[model samples]
Target: MSYETYAELKQLVLPHLQPIGTNYREAISGEQKLVLTLRCLATGSSFASMTVPFHMSNTSIARHVLATCEVLWKVLQPTEMPIPNEDKWKSLAKRFGDLWDYPFAIGSLDGKHVALVNPMNSESLFYNYKGYPSIVLLALSDADSCFTLVDCGQYGRVSDAGVFQASRISQLLDQERLIIPDESFMVSTTEKRIPFQVVGDEAFPLKKNLMKPYAARTLDTIKRIYNYRHCRARRPVECTFGILAKKFEIFQRPMRLQPDRAITVTNACTILHNFIRRRDGHMIDRTSEINYEIRPNNEQGLMNLRPQQGGRNSDEATEIRDLIAAFFNDPRGSVMWQDQNVFRNVLLLED
Candidate 1:
């Protein structure tokens, strides 16, 4: 929060966190508690380390951080990461189209592993394929890079698709409980309709409401163009994760908290990230952030291809993808630069 906004927020949350008094001794002030919690989050200091400055026991520091985080989430969740209604979903899609030129895109989805020190007696559960002990922080971010929905504490070992499949939001999406509009939008001048959907990497399975890039092996111009556009649309979520990790240094290093506490801290950081984005306006577009993993030649498949699970129904996905490819190839929906940028060297190679 900015210096100007801190007092206002502190006042709003003070009533809930204020300690009850019995005339025996004065309790810690809410401002002090908030400061300590913010300090720990900003610095990723261990409870023991924070005790020195706060003049409190390690246990007290931990308790204060967890309790304050719960309160922050409870009060801030409705505004920060409220469930998307039809109008809001449409707004998100509209923004995606305006900024990224991808129509009917709801939001971008991705997962990142927050490193953790091994917990007592349960080491194997947190061990990930990257050969580290951590927990997954799967999130869906909007066009402006604010987190719309987040699910933390999934086992680090789980693949992006697995973490998504087991998430509560997945259950909601599968049962159509989110009420994501049954609406479709025109992707072409001829009125080819494509459903509004969230885009993810190849790790996520394709559904009517979710889209992923086409594999990069083919030489077809249409598929390559579609893949390039889809990858661009998915960049926001990756940028969100990048900004979140950069802002919260804890994610850059292994956290020494227990699994449950780690979840609380992770959720707290995510909530605070949105808080800063909303109040402080620290949203920066990192679209040009250099990623060595994705070279310009085959940038379409930058999002790694994990084993696709739980789908034998990619027929509709394939059809929609083909339609999008056709749209990009058409003169109406085609950007002027795409023809040269996408097919520049390919045509030379063909010749």
Candidate 2:
């Protein structure tokens, strides 16, 4: 929020966070706190660096950043995502490479570990390939790369499958309830209406609502095109992750704070990112002020593989090689997949 914008927001929300402190130091004020946090997020500077510019103590800055994030996170996280219904899953199958549309139409489920400095206890649990200990943030990103669902705080040792199993979404899938709204329909003898489903890597199981891509088969064109198109759309969450890790810089390195608090801050940043993106950063293109994680080298995307799974030999290179081949084959790839809706709804247009 800018200077005037901050003033306006304070007035509108004034009735809400009245300061218990007689002075600014006593209790966290409202807008000032928000302003400080935004500044920290945008600048990605150290607390020591921010203390002078924001005119607050290091401890105070940390408190406000955490407190403001807590409040905003509750308001930002989507309790329910839009589009698709229980009855419509089959109907929408044509839209996703002839695959049955389940609960989530074009969601891509994946886990990313944000590098953090090793903590004191430094359990082996948090260490990942980057050679640093960090927490795991598993998310379900739509084709547009927007994170429709997110789960954080798991130690890095937990795999994507493990994170999903422990998530509320996993529970819903197990119960046969989809995340769609009240208006959607459910069929068969059962009265329960399962909403949409989600897409994931090979690590996840295929139930009523979750779908995973085959890791092998570079020669198969259909699955290859399917994977390519989905990834083109799904890269947004990666883009979002890139922005958070880079601009916030704190995330690029091992976070020294308590793991739980670090998770909170991370989630808070994600929510705020979506909020900002919703306002102005909606497209996964260049509109964002921060974009890290350099583009994959086409000459090397396939041959170059990011090693994972405890230093065991990885076949991701071959899979990625197939992906590049599939990408060039798709007409939709020409559009650059700026919005995920393009892929989710692409099959609809052709049909």
Candidate 3:
């Protein structure tokens, strides 16, 4: 973060972080507290590791870090990650169409596992399929690679679909309380209107407003094109995760704090991510840290290889998927380079 950005953030949270001085000794200033918290987040240093440098005891460092993190979330979340209204959702959809060429996509969804030390007496509840104790950080990111919404601290054992099912956004979606825009026609197509949706990987169920790629083995050229376009549109969330992990080194290793505190730390990092992005502009160069290749062998046999964990898809969802696939193959909705990209290896196969 730049000095200007840090100064602005410090000003916003200073009121909440200020400490009262006593006759015995001067209290730590808010500036010092903020610096201590940022150092821990940026370096993932243990509280004990911070003690000698800050000239404070480990307990004092931990207390101040936790307190400052809580304040950062409280102060920053309202502005940095505000709840999206219907107009905001529409704006996001427009951005996706313009940038990624996927119409009516309001956001891209994914889950990231933050490693954790097992909480006492919790058994294997936190242990995940990857053989680590973790907490899931499920996020919805906009086309600009900024997080629009996030749910932190889910047990790592649950699948991405399971975590989404239990999320508050899922409840809002079910109750029709979220202000998502109504169904609208796709660009260059007048056949039928489709609901605004979020794109995710196979772990998510196909819902009226959520899309996953079709099963890999069953895909033909048209479906492969759909998956290709779908993955392109979904790349921002992956990029956002990469940027977050790179910027906040705390995520590189398992957090030593308890589950609740770990959640606080995660939330703080996400809020700060938005804060920095808004100030520093989008990090377009960092997208290369993640692979963008869509190899034919991998696309045909390996991607979406895992059996989708969520239950049966509704007929409406199936129709939506088919309609999208058809659109991608049609002249009106097709891209110029898609055919060449999808079939670039055909001669090798023929040989």
Candidate 4:
């Protein structure tokens, strides 16, 4: 964004802010604090580089940016939380399938590694799958590119699956509230125990809701389109990661701060990202990312009990499948798009 955009955001946030004192209690003037934050997020520059333009020390810049983030997350939007309850999710599902013309109507999941200067007790968690030191940030975003859920501070070495299972989302799933639709499921090793699956790449194990694309050689247009459409919807999460990496170059560079600081900064960038997106009236770019190759997994997964022997007895499978199919089938119907949109969201979330 340009200077005007940052200035506009500063204007919006300033009124909500608690005034800075005369002394540099947090290492800079109030104006400089906001300026440093804008530079960090809008330009994606490092603290050291940002310090030159503001004429402040790098440590001071980092402190201001972090403190400002605290204010944004805690004060400006005390009620803001990533997890959406059923009613809100149903509403989003409608927009996903209708306004966005995307498929599966579920939030996309992905992990981003924020590089950090190795800290103490980092031996186990900071290692990323890429064979480097980092912290893992797991995010789930909708087709609109807004984050519905965000998880940070896991060590880079932790697998996406591991981070997810240990997250608050996992707790939600355990309560049987995070309903996964049929198309979201993949062929599981064993099943009946935990029926809902989390959609992810092949690196993720096959469970009821976890889905993957068929091989390129075997996929037909419908399957291909389905996969493409699902991916199209999911790109927001990846795009958000890009924006964070691109704008806050610090996220891309290794960090020297504590783990808590890294987590706060990541959340701060997200809150700021939403701020910019809300102003612009959009969340994601239109460019398409089309790679569909599946990754190979070497570790064997533990087996869960399979679906009950009684076929046709489970309505869960049927209901979810229909929900997924509606994305592609309902748009062109003569009954009108809005009606279908309403009917579909109500059906999916009511149960």
lDDT of each: 0.77, 0.54, 0.83, 0.57
Q: Write the per-residue lDDT of candidate 1 for residues 1-351, one digit (tens) a residue.
A: 688667766866788898866788788888888898888887777789877888999988888888998887887788888999988987787677767777667899889898988877876888999898988988888888889889898998899889999997788877778767765654334344566778989898877677888777764778888887888888888888887887777777899888898898889888888878777775444322111110122222212223234656356666666776776677766676776777766745543
Tens-place lDDT digits, model 2, residues 161-217: 787778766775565465342232222322232224455666765443454554654
Lowest lDDT 10-residue stretch of candidate 4? 288-297
Cα-based RMSD of candidate 2: 12.6
Comparing 2 and 3 on lDDT, the stronger one:
3
For each candidate, give its TM-score against the true structure: 0.88, 0.63, 0.90, 0.67
Task: Compose the digit string of candidate 4's lDDT tens values, residues 1-351.
Answer: 556767876665666555655564653455666766766765557778776678778777777788887776764343345556655655565455453454234666777778777768767677676776777787777666666677788877877778877776656655556643322222222222122233455344333354444345765434444445445556667776786676666665676677888788788777766666666645443432211111122233221224333423234433333334333333331123334433453333444
Tens-digit lDDT string for candidate 3 (1-351)? 999998899889999987999999999999999999999999988998888989999999999999999999999999999989988888787778777878658999999999998777779999999988999999999998999999998898999999999997777777668777653544343344566789999999888788999998897888989999899999999999999999999998899988999999999999999999989975442111111111122222211223333578877777777887887787877888888887787553543
lDDT of 1 at 322: 70
Off by over 4 Å in 2: 1-16, 23-28, 78-106, 180-196, 246-249, 282-351
Q: Could you give me the TM-score of model 1 versus the true structure?
A: 0.88
Name the candidate that leads on lDDT: 3
